[model samples]
Target chain A: MNPLPALAAAASEKATQSGPTLAVSDLRISAKRDRKSVELLRGVSFHVASGETLALVGESGCGKSITSLAVMGLLAPGLSMSGEVALTDAGGRIDLVALSAAERRKLCGRRLGMIFQEPMTSLNPMQRVGDQIAETLTTHGICSRQEAARRAVAMLDRMGIADPGRRALALPHELSGGMRQRVMIAMAMIGEPDLLIADEPTTALDVTVQAQILELIRDLSRERGMATLFISHDLAVVADIADRVAVMYAGEIVETGPIDQVLDAPLHPYTIGLIASRPALSTERRARLSAIFGAVPEPGRRPQGCAFHPRCSLAKPGLCDVGDVPLKRFDGRDVRCLRVGERVQA
Target chain B: MSIANVTSTSDRAPEKVPDARWLGLLKGLWRHRLGRAGCIVLAVLVLVAAGADWLAPHDPTEIYYDYILVAPDSRFWFGTDELGRDIFSRVLFGARVSLQVVAAAVALSLVIGAAVGLISGYAGAWIDNGLMRVMDGLMAFPALVLALAIVAVLGPDLLNAMIAIAVVNTPGFARLVRGETLVVRELDYVQAARAMGASPLRIVARHVWPSVSGNVLVYGSLKASAALITESALSFLGLGVQPPTPSWGYMLATGMQYTQAWWMSIFPGLAIFLTVLGLNLIGDAARDVIDPRTQR
Candidate 1:
């Protein structure tokens, strides 16, 4: 190993756990597409408290994106959703799902901010960068227009955009990809939103910009005391920024624990396979990276028992593939496997 | 990393030339020969229409009974109509009427059509269907027949002619805008605006409107060209402007009686042709530049 992963794993483990969790429980979403009502998420649950980063990692189509959207109340119309996404406020913890969209959107205004995968298109191309930031501020009634413009420049200045005053006047199409991503981050975090959901925020940037942006997010989380649900497919990224990590497969969280515990001593076979699949340092020249056997199944056709059993190495003939496998305790964390102990011991 | 950590050479590049916006639009037009020619022709027509009062040698409606059926000469240029009105002066003033009819009808239709389109597109399945069906009913009629019916009910007057053409043009705008709105409303920036506590009105005004502007400009010019031709037809049918007004269509009607003079009908007819041709060229050029999918 090159030692970065080991170093990152240790740092994430050392990060402390804090107050009340952003507490998601029993979330379900189904949508009617192609004349079929597919259950996209099945009783998915996890939490991230203020001052904590929970990395929700999984492959494409594994319900990680759906879960974050549900938390933010941004699921597309015609989808059926049922779940409790509770966040603590001065009024006390309230379930976001129980509220109307307009009502939930009110909470989203001052409290929630989300950054998505493509920053290039997230800001309107016709709008000036300063005005775009000022719009969010003015729309929320946070400040006067003049003040918003001034603050926008200051915010851009802080975001490391040189000569923020001039840059603010330029249209979004005038900016580069990484510069636009920085603009997006400034817009999302400008009001110091309480719950920051970053769904693969750095996935589109170059490697160096990715590192810088990730560092910026981590720094923001630390300074703002905001609860963050960092969703990603990149394990190395999760190892660096996440305090806790949850591995999702087939609409359910199959494994979760402290980053060091989950990544170093993973109890679930899928998690083991995922970490093993990384192209890491090895003396064996041109060695092939390990990969999980099969792709994640489409929503409606998910197999019985453990969702990963078909691709899992430690799957037993009857116990692992016969029925639903509920999450159970192992190694001071949760793992959804009946043969986790048997497989690990062997 | 703060200011000094920013190395311009290593950062992402923005592929653009920093041209002033209005200048950029003009430059783009200049690059296309068809667009430039269309703009020049249209500009000359507008200038003539605006300056007709000062430029014309004779009053468009001034009667010269002695010059009735007279041929083109130094005394009565473009000859004289059977009513003894100067055909050249009438043709010059007719530019004003053509521009007014097209401009008013296009403006009215764009506002009404865009509003209907945006609301219908945003209203979802059943509501959208209901609004679109009503528009479809309007569209089902042969355009000229429907315009004639509207003009007949409103009476054969100038304002009524503009209104009739506007009503005829509304359905086209509504359909274009609605189709565009359906795609634009789903853009990420629009959704992001919604996430920021922006009401439906704000999102539509800020995000949706701007994206569809290029479509609106191209289609508006196209509809304006059609409306000018429709106005001439309505006037020719004696259902537009009125008899005394020096409209090109009315001029054409008078010109028919003095076909021997030829200049009476020919000049006005030529004026109408060139005006419509200019508008059409402008529309084609705008569509080519604005609608990316149609570009070569």
Candidate 2:
């Protein structure tokens, strides 16, 4: 058995015996527009064993961010959702998708926390950064204003924010992009939630800041023993952070397995294409950077059968065009491809 | 992790505090010549209106038959009206009436309209459509004409006039607030608040309302000026503040009957014109100062 899968299986077994921190199964989301409904997420499923980081990696419009939003119950109006987003917190297992908006709100910030993409825009401009953090604490009834403010400052200090007391009073605009993102992290982690969803958290920051924020997330997740759902478009970034990686294409997860296996021996063509497209400094100078041909298919115009058939290099002309391939497990990895089980020598 | 970390950490000790932009904005208004002048004029008018009872040398309604139509003098400053009432004293008192009506009407309109607009704009869907359609229907009627119609129905009285002016101004304030609410509702902070598990009401109160207040406040000031003019117009038409009471518009109306008597018309007309002009200037300045987009 491969070491990565063995590690993942061991982790899963450990979590199964101890209980999962969060489990989302068969989560589907559809959006309606102009009297027509479009499926945004089609039976997407994943779970985060306690203290494990699960990365949902895909190009933009592949529903990676949508999955995080769905998990958080932050989907916008006109979108219909189904399936279970279950959390096994101290309160016991509860289906988040079935909860009322108020009940969902109660869970949010208390049990399930989120750090958004753009820290600059995600924070209220008129409010002081400290007050914003305090608001989260007070909203969840975790503490009084005075206690929340005190905790907020301490949290900011812990997040490596300089002069936490004074910086607390500063507006989001006053802080640097990195500092603002740090404040966002501080706010999200203030409650020490069981599940923390970081939706493209480092996408807007500089490379140095991105590394810092990623390290911060990693360190904090480990310290709190929280299950992290880290969503990102950069496969390289996810490779370092995720224990398991779920590669999505056309709103469906095309492959999901241990990060090392998915990166080293990707079974799905989409995953292979994504992996190969990463520019490598170690490769030959004459080797052109591989790129997936064509943009992501528009939601309503997604192709039938295998969604990646149009762009798949290994596609069989007749078979790939004819039948939809359901995700099937092979060697402990789930791949949605017809040739995964077949021994076709490349 | 080294001495570089220690010095780097020390370098972070007291980052310069960014200047408060809103406070800077207020300072800009204070420095602006036109805005300052406007503010001074408004302050003087407000003081005069507030202290009218103590400032007026004579009871505005108390008449002196022998001194009727007397020209400007040390005793009867702006002169006397046809009824031998001190026009200066009456004009001072008229400032009180006009100012009171404007303040009351604007306050009432802002409270009612802002609540309605916030509900309509934020709630959206059928609630937005229904409330906005009603506002549109109300706005279709000319502001002054609507006030006149309402006053006529309610029977001409000071309270009726104030209520009429407030009712007429309500839709304008509602529309202004609703437009602002719609714009503010889409702001990222509002969306963030919503995503952070804030209820719709909490989002509106904490995130939406604060941002929209500056716009609403500036517009509300302008609306007060409009209400003032409308109240004056109603009084000028003999449909507002009865004859015995001191009203700038009433004074102007009665004063104009005697075309030969210039002081009769000039003093009250000038008072009304200056007050309205001062309010408009202040309102214009406020709009520029509160909205950064308008700043040069």
Candidate 3:
């Protein structure tokens, strides 16, 4: 009664519509062979608002890449997906999952652009870098071929490439790995898509190039007010760029919160383990970086109850491992832990 | 934007830069003197094939009874075959038939084999197994034996022999491009194409085909050489270029019986040997030039 009502009203006024630019709901991906099916992603969901960067952070096999692929509708052959992905804009919203492959393709590289982890092999080696970027523009009917070329050169220049006009004529192989990655970014962002999905974009690069690439992505996203669904396994890198973070474990997002709160005060055991594992100034010199014990379970072999139970230090034998622990909110943050700022009723 | 230590690379010489790279690939080929020699041999063969009619000193089939089996006299150069046909003239004209047969075999294998390779490698699984099995079955028999059997069935003639040789060699090309495509299809660039919203057809045409074509063409050249040798074997067996056409193999077959007429067999055998050698050299050189892994 003191000030809560006024704060709530201000929140509503600040965001007249709290809806997201892209919403992915309850995505489940599996592969089937001979009557046996193995789940890759289990009911993963998240929303990305305009001008917000939401990072999906997980170790390998935690289904981060699969989720990104599912969102892009580029899941490899033999994998099947069931979900809903809505892309919203000023023109209104369209269900990405409901669209036919042809329609989804039309939206891809136009409304939704994506960059991959391997900058080394992400571009066609035979095509000139400028032509490759122009191809994306021409395919989307974004501009005339000549206009596309001019824009491609301009985009390269904006990426801080020296002699952008001459560099545009170079092949992917002729360029350094960092330069090639910049070319890839130009190709993806030239469309100025509403949503940009960068799946571990800097994983293949060295540390310095990594920072440069991250800065480029951050600047470009801010300039375009583009929403991003960034996927990575590196918690330190994620901390540097992501505004909000969703930590996944064994095909499910186990925790989610704003970056500051999540990094400063992690709720789920897994998130705590991730933040602890990052090498920091305060970390003891000889002490090993803390790591979550054991491994993410293979699909079809995920432990029952809390998928993270096998290695979770706070796991209550009878409760945490008894059944699937669905994500729920506590203290205005999402978590899947059995005990997180909660008292046992018994 | 600092690019960090990525600078100073220009003086270091990048690992992948092809030396003397130019659109014509002339510098690359000329780097190896043997390859240049091979190119010269092929050029000469083409000129001889094209001008066979004007180059022959006499009608190839002319039975010069007056100079029957003479031993390399300038008056009747390369002596004469058992039928008194001008051995020199027949050898000259034989170049035309050899080149035509090789050309036809190469064309057939190039189209049919490349298409099969693309489908098998790209489609994969059962389609891959099924198409590859048919190729395996064809490859099971020794090329010459299979070509001979096919000639026996189609009723021996130059065209039948060429068709048989084409059939025999198609499997090699299919396997070559299929292996190449399997590697290419999994490359990240391929997935990038899909992410670019390229349709399956566009991805295949624009991405898959170009990367695979270079190796396929290289393999095609080697297969052409094999076809030429196989055609010679067929003609030697009376299954190709029926007599009086003056094919090198046919000339050698009859020339072998006349021990006193040494020039009878020597000239035709030299022609066949040189043509096959020329082809092998060109193919090997092309492979070296196009595949960076093989470059020095």
Evaluated with DockQ, which candidate comes out highest? 3
User: In model 3 chain B, which range of ten residues has the least summed lDDT?
Assistant: B15-24
Worst 10 residues of 3 chain A by lDDT: A1-10
Q: Residues B68-156, candidate 2, lDDT per residue (tens digit)?
A: 99999999999999999999999999988999899999999888898899999898989989998988888899998889999999999
Of the candidates numbered 1 and 3, which has the greater TM-score value? 1
Ten contiguous residues with the weakest lDDT in model 1 chain A? A1-10
Encode model 1's per-residue lDDT on B1-296: one tens digit a residue: 33223224212422112224335445555565787787888898899899999988899889988878788899778888887878788888999998999899999989999999999987668978988998899999988899999999988899999999999999999999999999988888887787666778888898898788777887888788899889988999989888777899888876787567778788988988888777777777777665546655
> Tens digits of per-residue lDDT for model 3 on A53-146?
8899988989999998888888877898888888887889899878888998888888888998898888887788898888788877878999
Q: List the residue pairs that clash in candidate 3.
A: A305-A323
What's the C-alpha lDDT at position B181 in model 2?
88
Q: Estimate the TM-score of every prediction.
A: 0.92, 0.92, 0.90
lDDT of 2 by residue, A273-332 (tens): 888888887989888999989788899898878999888777788888787789988877
Please write out the lDDT profile of model 1 over residues A170-256, one tens digit for every residue.
Answer: 777667777788888888888778888898999998878888888889888778888889999999999889888899999998998
True contacts kept of 1: 0.33
Model 1's alpha-carbon lDDT is 0.82
